[model samples]
Target: MRLEHDLAVRREARDIIADDVAIGVGDGWQHLVGRALVTIRDVTDGKVNARQIKERQGLLSIFTDIMIRGSETIAQRVFDVTNGAADQSAWVCEMCGCGGRLIAGNRLRVRCQVCEADEPERERVWREHRDDILEAAATYIRVCLEHSRLFPVYNIVIRVCLDDRDHRLFLDEVHDRLVWWRAGSWIEGVEDALRQDFRRLDFAR
Candidate 1:
């Protein structure tokens, strides 16, 4: 979340928010969170304890452990209010605070039509196990470099590894990073720089 939004919510709901409570969601849900916290405070009569507020799998996840002095009915009310807020966030864009839906991509995210339209294409394979694929690619590059020379030969080997799915995912991520940063080729070092970062590859046989 933006610092201003976070601080605003904290200020508005200071009566309910405990010192250690964490708010770790995006800006789009700021209104929802703020409103919910206020409602919770009102319903619980300023006797609630919030543990955490974060995003999980493109949805809001709020944890508020009610105080011991709180009544069972009030606790249930807090649960209902917080859960309702979380449910509401499912349709709220995490970026621009517009109506959004869960989008399937390299990562699951709630994005409005405009933001979704602006996103780059990502394959289903990239969505599932993307981190693992990138790790495998890194290990492969490290391994290839260790087994082979570092000049034109390493480049040829890395290019050939592109025929494998994992390596291609890594390349796709590299391209995506380039686009994200609006980087020109020379500003970011060449592919060799990427290869040089890898020290070794493990062949699990």
Candidate 2:
């Protein structure tokens, strides 16, 4: 993030966050966090309290956890905003906050080099294999993938558990992305042939 843009974000955050959040790491994720803070302030009618403390910069996106101080309804709204912030990071560069895409592999990463000039050698070991589905429910599915030490940058585990309507909406977004990544980008139709048992999970139904 440029100095000017970074300063601008701080000003924006200062206005909305006001005296509620004392400390935050609003770096690299200025816009996403800024938007969430604005929403949090607006929806809660300035009754919410929150502060971002960490940034989980993943291969596909960035994530952050906030210390939220509010009622249950306010807490739920914070979660929604946080998730939205992370999801929006999928296409935004973790370095410069520009448009970017995932660079998957044994060491999954993203294409921030397009803007920031830092490109690592691509090593794709995402292959046709199956791991035990440790748990699967109507709203979420989990399969063991490479551990964090091995694939530190990639989001090896994705658990999308939401309400029925939100679940479908979220899965629909994942489906569309898979059509591009699983079908077009990475393993051709192999995700379909390989993870065939995935349908049995019945997360959508």
Candidate 3:
């Protein structure tokens, strides 16, 4: 996606302010202005981590009732930064294979109007197509990983358990590989138990 015009303008303003601060345009305000400029720059450049950017942007104040608000606050920021140019349409319907006329009305739900014409059939098809469900799950997981910028180790773990139950041995092997590469630890045994339980299920076979 192209950078938003408003964001570009704000970044330019930040740079100008930073330059002024460097040349002693405002002695006492230098530090505050400089830090603010840096924060803006980092956020615009996608360099600031989510937590840091959230704190800097004061997102907490704008969002109370975290459970209820969902990602609306962040979505609005993204929209604003992109000058309302982000395509908010659902790329594909999880329920049906239909592509167009999918409305993103709620955070959790994406409904395709054409598919809604026969809800029973859509649900039946979705339930019957195990491979399609697995493919969708894998695609969703991949998109999430990419958006979150997750580590390769986590990606491997997620990939191995994408459409299946967690496996301890599988997870342990992933961890071992990471360790061999001198990566950080981030394993949870509960995931392995879940995998084992899933593996034993007849339906999963």
Which candidate's TM-score is highest? 1
Q: What TM-score does candidate 1 get on C-alpha atoms? A: 0.54
Candidate 1's error at 47, in angstroms?
0.8
For candidate 3, what is the lDDT? 0.30
Per-residue lDDT tens digits for candidate 1, residues 38-122, read 9988998877767778788888887776846578898888889978987898889976689999987777889899757644433
Q: Runs in model 2 with CA error above 4 Å?
A: 15-28, 57-68, 103-110, 119-205
lDDT of 2 by residue, 1-205 (tens): 2223333444565544432232233234567766776776677676654543234455322222334446676667767876777677667765557776655654433346543343321111111111111111111212322111111111332534334433333333333233233112333323434333432222111
Give the alpha carbon lDDT tens digit for every residue of 1-205 in model 3.
Answer: 0112112223444432211111211111222223443443344453222111111111111111222333565444433432221122233332332443333322233335654444445344445543433443334334433454323333333443334323322332332222222112123322222322322222111
Order by lDDT, highest first = 1, 2, 3
Query: What ranges in model 1 sit over 4 Å off?
Result: 67-69, 117-205
- After superposing candidate 3 on the true structure, give the runs of residues whose Cα lies further than 4 Å from its correct spot: 1-43, 48-79, 82-87, 90-119, 129-205
Cα deviation of 80, candidate 3, in Å: 0.9
TM-score of each: 0.54, 0.42, 0.22
Give every collision pair in model 3. 165-195, 166-195
Task: lDDT winner between 1 and 3, please give it.
Answer: 1
Worst 10 residues of 1 by lDDT: 178-187
Which one wins by TM-score: 1 or 3?
1
